[model samples]
Target: MKNNIILSWIEEGVVSIPSFLFSEYKSIGLTDLECMLILQLHAFMEKGNSFPTLEELSNRMTLSLEQCSQTLGSLLTRGYLEILKGHTDQGIYFEKYSLQPLWKKLINHQLLVEKEQTEQQLKLEEGSLFTIFEQEFARPLSPMECETLAMWIDNDHHNPALIKAALQESVMSGKLNFRYIDRILFEWKKNGIQTVDQAKQQGKKFRSHQQKTKVEERKKGGTDTVPFYNWLES
Candidate 1:
């Protein structure tokens, strides 16, 4: 008998609510009561009751029928709920509730929030990149230099880490200047080196070739030497 009762309860089914609605309702300008009312409507609709009466809705909650009607009116006014009217085969008119507006609002709000977070993160990264550039140069950047850096990121679409790698390469080669760093960046792009590891590998290969050339020159009794890997020349 208990198993039969449990099976009957299970047959009654459950209401499906979007998990995000619980967390993000307030962000989309819905109060607790309004959100709860929406949940009740959703439950009723899921049970094949498209338009549950205010009395039926309020019977399951602390609200009175009048309060439920007011809340429904407010939801319609605020574009969170919509009543769709249609006719049946016998030309009978019927009204049903649609939660589409609410779903759309929730999705749009989430997208806007994600966009804001991405912009904030990008701003923080840009600020740190600028500070690192100033420290490396040992001076505050001029307006033109600042513009150039912005151009590298915004227009040229260079990654901050890649730009920093180019700067380091310039410093190591004893050519600590913007023009030299630009040339390094250009050569790196030309060679399809998007990562610092790839840049390091390219430098190692060049140094190995230079070492082989030096050994051959020594055998030929020539004593000329190249001190640094000049990216501009490459």
Candidate 2:
């Protein structure tokens, strides 16, 4: 009864993984068994085994039912496996397993790696723009805030000089948040205000108008005077 089942299956087929997965997934903290679990899920997909039960999975490997359940739970918790609901040919809905989360993660990790490589390439020539933000904001930047600043510099084509100018302008105007700084940048770009000198000249004009408005309100003896620093509109 213990005929050559192992030899027969070896003669039947084999599972293959992308060569890059070994290094990349491991670099991202997946252990050997975790990677094998992913590969086994792929094998189940290849066999059209929609929802491989714990017993079926346990039969394929040396793991017990509880071990298989725990491994699957770990994968789910780590966001590598997702369950999908589907309909059978007879119009019955059932749950199936998917490896889409892994693929999505691969794409994101690839982008993050590429970003790091680019930063390293430029490190010798340029200082970190993130440091400038942290200095101006007077606190350590969160990961999200660092990413946003990186996007502004790398993706939005914002040069550090202009960004620093925006920061200074925001501080001078008593508005220091990213939203106000972004609005200042947008207004400058819209009005063709390129240099700090141009921005200063524009500020002077705004102050002149504001003073004139205040003087007129005073002449009328109005209790409410015009805002002294209304350059934000300008």
Top candidate on lDDT is: 1
> lDDT per prediction?
0.90, 0.76
Q: Model 2: per-residue lDDT, tens digit, 71-177?
A: 99998898988999878899998999988888778778889999999877565223555677788888998887777677766787665667777777777777778
Model 2 stretches astray by more than 4 angstroms: 1-11, 14-16, 125-234
Clashes of each: 0, 0
TM-score of 1: 0.72
lDDT of 2 at 42: 83
Candidate 1 error regions (>4 Å): 1-5, 88-92, 138-144, 151-162, 165-175, 183-234
Worst-scoring 10-residue span by lDDT in model 2: 225-234
Q: What is the lDDT of candidate 1?
A: 0.90
For each candidate, give its TM-score against the true structure.
Answer: 0.72, 0.49
